[model samples]
Target: MKSSNFLKYTALLVFAIAIGFFAYMVNASKALSYLSHDPKACINCHVMNTQYATWQHSSHARDVGCIDCHLPRDNMVNKYIAKARDGYNHSVAFTFNTYKNAIKISDDGAKRVQENCISCHASLTSQMVKNADANHNYDDPSVATGRRCWECHKGVPHGKVRGLTTTPNNLGVKEVQ
Candidate 1:
């Protein structure tokens, strides 16, 4: 009976310790920073230095934030859900040091960015659509088939900085060029 009781206590203690450690790690990493729309929250991870730096000089910097473009505008619940999912994924990736050096957006992220671009630049996209309709040609691949904004305007947020350098994994501060 005493041995069984001891084993039960040990299991409970281990579980509590694990929960405590996880909480500590999350707190130290500023995981809650993802909940806010601040662009600086993006640079909390050293890997984001290039993106953050590029965005500083981008035209969108004056108007929208990181979350504004990256997250969905469907509703608050959906937005928070996406944020939590991304935050969890980022935390796990950073914890395991498993993220790729050249960080690429997931398909879902790309969709969100495309949606944001269409919503934000409704006037411009409408004009493009009107032009495409007038110039519609079945043989022309260039004609608008509702191509994503990034498909043509790839240099909006990140600029032409792709393929510059592999993201550093050591968490050392490097100069963003």
Candidate 2:
């Protein structure tokens, strides 16, 4: 009876240790996220090779990784769901070479990103745009609603901060003459 009791206690202890280890890993991951970004994480499969090279050469390379601009912040549960869905979709696409068949982004992604841009740039909204004259009209729905920003800023790392990110391979609608 004593031997059996000892065995059960040992099993319980092992289970507790396993749970602790998992918790430790989760906690450690939050810190790791801020330390560095692995660009290879984006290209873990075949779907990413095209944008992969262009992203590497962009001025956005200096700072602001892919996640910084694209993945908008959200509540914990929503964030978890978003990350899981993205991971699953990317994995399947990579496995099947579906990224080569990637379609142009629909309006959904852009609209979501427009909200994030507003959140980040809220400080600038009240300030007049650099070239605005006193008589210039200012209440356009596009600017007020953040839609106007995307017209000229559709490329990665938006704004004139770095201009458009173009690779030697794709420079224009036709070709980079």
Model 2 TM-score? 0.50
Candidate 1 contains a number of clashing pairs equal to 0
Which residue pairs show backbone clashes in model 2? none
**Candidate achieving the largest lDDT:** 1
Top model by TM-score, which number?
A: 1
lDDT of 2 at 167: 21
TM-score of model number 1: 0.72
lDDT of 2 by residue, 20-122 (tens): 9988965753424422455545544434444555556556656656555445576656555655666667656655766645434435456555566555565
- TM-scores of all predicted structures: 0.72, 0.50
Cα lDDT of model 2 overall?
0.53
Evaluate residue 89 in candidate 2 and report its C-alpha lDDT on the 0 to 100 scale.
Answer: 70
lDDT of 1: 0.77
lDDT of 1 by residue, 90-175 (tens): 87888799989789898899899888887888877677656656233223577636556676676788776654353333435354
Model 2 C-alpha RMSD vs. true structure (Å) is 9.2
